[model samples]
Target: MALTSIKTSGDKIEIVNQLLLPHTTEFIEIDTIEQAHDAIKSMKIRGAPAIASLAALTVASHLSRALQADPAPEWLSSPQLLDPYITAQLDFLYTARPTAVNLGAATRRLKHTLRTGVEQGKDASAIAQDLIQEGREIDAEDVSRNKRMSKWGGEWLIEQVKAKGKSPESLNVMTVCNTGSLATSGYGTALGLITYLHETRKLSRAFFTQSTPYHQGSRLTALELLTLKIPATMLCDSMVGSLFQHNDIHAVVVGADRIARNGDTANKVGTYNAAVLASRHNIPFIVVAPVSTVDLDIADGTAIPIEQRPALEARLVRGAVYPFTLNAQGVKEQATVMVTPEDLEGVYNPSFDVTPAELISAIVTEKGVAVKADGASGFDLSSIV
Candidate 1:
């Protein structure tokens, strides 16, 4: 069965608590705007596209419940009040995670919907209805876009291998972090391309890095591939270099939280290390993300913001016991243990790192695939964006 990050039934919205993933599956509800904001900020729900979808859908659900309230909210009394209230809510959600451009894009799109309805002189309720539909659309559109970009990336890799006089069949591809259904509205970005190759029988194995500190790759991506019955191998973050030296890796693919206009990508923190290693190995490094992940306002990676995680996060690890005992509820019992000394200091833990465009062989989006021009150091991105 496929893993889902968020589940919505009618007006209800629930997301899987990714922090306790692999060992356990837990669902948490988001009924209020504050709950959605906390979910994104607290890292209970993540991935650039997934968080954005949750933020948008939560707004839709909030408005839906308000429209059916015994006494309509005062904000619904007029377009003026409703507009500001919803705008404030969107703005708050955007602040939950500043690094992921998709969250900002989702908020901006809803803001646009609100502006269009208000300009048409629609009533407060009418404008609220418009916002609801737009929010739902934002979440609904992610899956199709993911599939399109995955296909574009998967086929492009095959062509690249074939051009080098090598067979595309049984190609081995590597990825970092958890870019799968659990990381997005549905399907995925980088992992989606690996899934595409698997479905088409062109893949021999799927390789993923353990993604240090958070272990999204080990805890989340490993579970995703297992559930899908995809053949996969896990390597510690530092093993990437050794893996490339010992194996015939065709490419290293990853999902982007943000991509500057020149194609520099900000993704999982260890992504840059993987990109640098891929370059040394002469392996193609591809980034697969939706067009929304592209930030036209940012000219390069230096301008992109990098989120720093709590220092304690890097010192501890969470997992089930060695014997893997299950509680009365048949759920695995998990615990967090410190890997370093209690008073350890000077631990650096940034949530993401930027890979310069020169290291990126191609940037795949729903629109198409983008590659740097001959002898060029950066990508134009005009055609893909």
Candidate 2:
């Protein structure tokens, strides 16, 4: 299905503003490196891969514009000047989201292109042209890989269900956080798997957690699923146990923020809680992310750096006014409300939590699915990486 994120107009590119989502559907034009960096840092545009793609595409757009200018830019006339200028821009965008490796990978790829072009003794304009095409490829590749991983994960789940003697057509799956269209350039990771099942007529229903603090599931995932016309139900972060007790859920799929070599996963903060519950119920727990999210440098979850969000975010809730006042465009106007008492203290808001490998049932990437070794508690992702 065509997603709202990848809207191409002849040669122009724009992305939906995720910060104002659900309540507002604003498509912001991304024409410069500064805009891409700001969108990522401000959470106006997010999802690790999606942000990376935007950053790369912005660089491509800038160069494409430069190439077509009547007199051509001065920077394009000198190889030495052009190299530093492009390197600085990519590095600046890299700082916007230091945690996600994909963003760094994208920047590094561009840097490599620049250095290689220079070493090859190419002229300034030739190097600029090479960098531009490479940048566009970086953005275009993500959606294709995402679609591949989604299909792989989806098919595996169906086969697993059938092995249990259950009809794959009636399989119900649960997921945590938002891994739908908004979470990527398109398709998504784990959510993309759910979408694939629905598209092929093998899914019974899709259940998602509210993914609290951020509420990515409630706000972003819900919107994406609804837009696709997929049959889905929303649950609060605390309700995973309740849902498991009553529903015949076949699997639990989640998007990963980072994965250690031993399969310990750092995903949205409440994910470990859900993984624990899923394990108790003997339900399969799947972690879906690009290979870039796997950090071989981090031997285990303890070594992974978990980001702590501001206390204010944990205290406030933003959404459309409950009664819903329509704007001039007939869309609801949203408001922010403090969910906690004034001056609430001791709020713990780590952006993600680590799920030990022992609890994870499988790990899926664009490359392929990695399952735990027989009788082993964790995975050795060295080959995959």
Candidate 3:
């Protein structure tokens, strides 16, 4: 069976506890806007698209509960009160993760729906219903668009190889971090492209980096590939340069947390390293993302805020203990072991790194594939976004 990051049944929303993933499958229900915000902030649920879906759905569920209350909530009594309450909740959710722009986009979309409904002279109940519908739409739209971008990116990579006088069949691709369904509402961004190739019988094998610190690649991506029965190999982050030196990696595809107008991308921290190595090896470096990830407000990557993780997160590692210890619940017992000395000072752990547009060969979205001009260093994404 395929894995999903978030699951919904009617108005109830639940997310897998990613911290104990691969070894344990635990789903935590999100009952309110506060629960959604806390899930994003605590890294219990992540990925740009997944984060946006959870927030939007939580809002819908919150309002749904309010509508069924014995006495309608004060906020639901009037559009005037509903506006501030919903706006404040959306703002709080946006602040939970500052770097990924998708959450901001989702919140803004809900706010827009609320504003438009009110301006149309709709009653409080009607406006709330409109917001609820918009929120559900936000989550429902993710899967279709993800599949679209995946095909665009996957086909583009094939053509780029053909132009180089190489057979496009059975190409080897490298990716970093976790970009599969576990990271998104459905399909994926970068990993989805890899899946596209696999489904089309154009993939040789998928190579992934361990993505140190969080180890999303080793833990999450590895599990997803294994579950799908896709042939894959796991390598350490530092070994990317060495892998390029020896292996025939045709492309390095990555997903973005934020993409500046110039096509400068901020993604998982180790992505820049892979891009640089790909450049040295003459491998194509492609970025696969949705149009919403493009922040037209920002002219360059420098303007994109990079989130810094807690120092303790970098100092510790989590996994099921070796020698096969199983708890009474019949699941492998997981533990967090400290990899460094207690209270280690100066642990530099930025969750993401920005890769310049010059290093990117192509940026694929649902709209189309974008590449730099003949002599251009950056992308004119205005056309694509």
Candidate 4:
């Protein structure tokens, strides 16, 4: 029951509609660049890496189709004409989700490939082929890197426990949001490390927060863990502190949307709250993600741009009607109900929050694990990136 967020066949692309997860599985086709943009922006296909993959694959599909057209498109006539057209497409894709650094990284990488190919005197068709290959590679590389970082983070946690004169066996862990197979190409980020621990027989039970407004935790991560047959418990977003207080939780692991140069991490909205509580409970707080998530250009967390979701999104909840409302198809009848007052004037719905480097015990990437220098308040991630 390995769940895939995106699926592809040659130049055709499709993504699972994550909004209906845990209850329903629906695959929606992504045929055009605009469709890709809408899917990412609408959270039809989310998670930073997942959206980046969709964006890259969509670009590849577009170029591959253009190359096979009966009457060649005007933009494909020459590199001079091709450069701006492709550039505009990349720019448009970047605007789909502004907060995810991975999307920007993918687009920037493609632009560099395009520039280098043109400078090497490649023809427009050759350049198109090069761009297409690079885009596909961007999606293909996510799973392997995820596996590497999961091992790195999992082993680091075990060592940290042993150093504290505590048994590392059967460690209880808590996670903030969904970071399993449904969130990436495969494996995962933080959830991958939890899986690594379980696979190695070191995990007792995994706890996850029911991330409010999006329920990514209860819906997506819960499904992933159950599919893998891992023992897990679900708690409300408000229960993280209580879970830490009553449970011998070894660590709080989470996935990041973006990481600043000084090691500040931006993740799901409730992550900062979990980090603060973990710090108070003396629990290790780890950020697991690929290197592409790090943005060296941003000096600190304050500079990270937070995308605020629509106010209406915070006021509505979608789920199967209680008491088992089943349709003729045998699937539960789902509906979106207004949870807040119909005319509620004030609703705060920022999609992410930044956790200061001081609160984070370590950051793990495919390269390795990074910790702050002795007596330092922040990490200089210059080498890690």
Candidate 5:
């Protein structure tokens, strides 16, 4: 069975608690916009695309219930009353996570819908319905477009290999973090490209980093590849350089949290390290993501916000106790153990890092692949976005 991060039934949304993943499968219901915001802020529901989907769905669910209320809420009385209420909700949701541009894009898109409906002179109820549809579409469109970008990236990589006078079959690809079924609404971004290669029988093996602190790659990506029955190898984040130095890695594929207009990509922390090493090793580095991740307003990576997680998060690791400790519920007991000294004062834990456009071989979106022009340091992503 495929692993899912977000699941929806009618207006109710539930997400798999990612913190307890690979051991426990807990589905927490998101009943309100506040709950959705909290989930994203706390990292219970994460990944740029998945959190964006949740935020948009929460808005749709909120408006849906408002319409069905026995006596409609005061905010729904008219467009004048509705406009500020919905706008405020979206603004608050955007504050939950500052680094991922996808969340901001989703909110901005909804705000546009609201403004367009009002300008068209639609009544409150009609405008509410339009907003609801648009919100749902934001989530619904993710999966299909992910598959499209995956195909584009995968085929491009194969052709690049073939052009170099190498057999395209049995290519070994390395990836960072956890872009898989559990990261987005469906397929994925980088992991989707890896899956595409495997599906087309062009893959030999997939290598992934442990991605410390959160260990999303070890905990989430590992489980995902195992479920899909793909041949994979897990390496410590520190080993990316060694892996690249010794292995015939065809490419390093990663997903973007935010992609600047110059093609600079902010992704999980270790992604930059992999990109650097891949460049030294002459391996292609690919960034796969949806169009929503592209932030054209951000001229360069320096303008991109990097989220800092709690220092305590870096001091501890959560997992099932080895040697098989079982809890009363018959499941393996999971605990958070402090890996660093109790009095540890400093822990630099930034959630993501940016890879310069010069290090990137290609940036693939649902629209198409964008590459740097001859003698260019960055990509002109305006056309692709």
Candidate 6:
């Protein structure tokens, strides 16, 4: 619903390249499926939902161009030849990022289009047309869903504050990791909730954790909130407890990587730490994500597969040159600097950490808000999902 991440000019698609982000704003054109796969694999573009949207959009762009090519591809000439080709491409894109369930969902939607067209005995040309429309819809639907969830979560937070005999206006909220324009199709999830509060004149400030190792909070989330002119502050990953001690944070909001059937949430590695600290401080801990993030198959957090990033990634930092050094083109020179000792031993780098349902005060999706039963340690998410 928002034109933040995906920019389109006729048939072309370009995404803000995420690998060279924070210090530099470079938008790379993604005209082919291969480029989409490479961008996701190399981390040139990331954040589960965003990556999936790009993958789906890439296919749409490719098909759009193919339909308008100098000569239609032979596959488009016949129904039998085109089905397998499209199926293979969707499957390939699905593998780009394994941890984000959204990618899988996007691929599955595309596959459904393919199957329905075939089972209905549509010609190859008609099937291609349907797929191109479906692909773009996959990306388009994300933003609207994000907006709905943001409204649900944001309003719920305000009501919770008022019910507790506190002023609903001027609420201060803390969020972990990036859940903004750069992380989703648009508006964002948890960050969207924060933005909603700001827009409604009920927010005082938004405090975000640095979300160490990846620094999605410091680098990406900070840049996004600033762009939207939302009042916000950034704190290091280690300062969650300290922030709670001094700040009047109304709640701690976060985005989910995956949600198990029992309400266990898997999110950025530092999210569990924040949830633990929020519980200790008697603050409401909220999870905001699309219903697609709910994994009914997973019985609990233990069953959710956590992706472990390469050890080297935990020891390096990449940024533009500091101290006001300018490049030949008058731009800052960017470089990757290793932050760890020359020879370091074992590094524990998990892309996500599971937050038990007990620590979470509420789970907000587009459907509705789900809270744990009175004095319950876990939640039954079946009805909600």
The predictions' CA RMSDs to the true structure, in order, are 0.8, 2.0, 0.8, 0.9, 0.9, 1.9
Q: After superposition on all CA atoms, how large is the RMSD of candidate 1?
A: 0.8
Q: Which residue segments of model 5 deviate by more than 4 Å?
A: none
TM-score of each: 0.99, 0.93, 0.99, 0.98, 0.99, 0.95
Cand. 4 TM to true fold: 0.98
Tens digits of per-residue lDDT for model 3, 1-385: 6699999998899999888888998999999888999999998998998999999999999998888898888889888999999999999999999999999999999999999988999989999899899999999998888899999999998998999999989899999999989989888999999999999999999999999899999999999999988899999999999999998989999999999999999999999999988999899999999998999999999999999999999999999999879999899988999999886798999999999999999999889999999999999986678
Q: CA lDDT, every prediction?
A: 0.95, 0.85, 0.93, 0.94, 0.94, 0.86
Q: Candidate 1: which pairs clash?
A: none
- Candidate 6: where is the Cα deviation over 4 Å? 1-3, 382-384
Q: Pick the winner on lDDT between candidates 3 and 5.
A: 5
| Residue 97, candidate 2: C-alpha displacement in angstroms | 1.8
Please give, for residues 188-255, the per-residue lDDT of candidate 4 as tens digits: 99999999999999999999999988999998999999999999999999988888888899999999
Q: Model 6, 1-385: lDDT tens per residue?
A: 2326667776788888776667777888887899989988777777777888898888888888888887889878776788888888988987776768788888888889988988999988788889889888888888888899999999999999999999998999999988888888899999999989998999999999888787888888888888888888999999899999998999999998788888999999999999999999899999998887888877888988888888999999877777757888887888889998989988999889999999999999888899988988888775566
Weakest lDDT window of 10 consecutive positions for candidate 4: 376-385
**Backbone clash pairs in model 4 (N, Cα, C under 3 Å; residues 3+ apart or in different chains), count:** 0
Q: Report the poorest 10 consecutive residues by lDDT, candidate 1.
A: 321-330
Q: What is the C-alpha lDDT profile of model 1 across 121-190, one tens digit per residue?
A: 9999999999899999999999999999999999999999999999999999999999999999988999
User: Which residue pairs show collisions in model 6?
Assistant: none
Q: Which digits, one per residue and each the tens of the lDDT, describe model 2 over residues 1-385?
A: 4456645564487888876778788898877788888888877777778877888888888888888898988888888989989988988998886767678788888899999999999998888888888888887777788888888899888889989998898779999888777868788899899989998999889999988887888889889888899899999999999999998999999988778889999888899999999999999999889887888887888987777778898888888887889889899988888989897888988888899999998898888888988999989886656
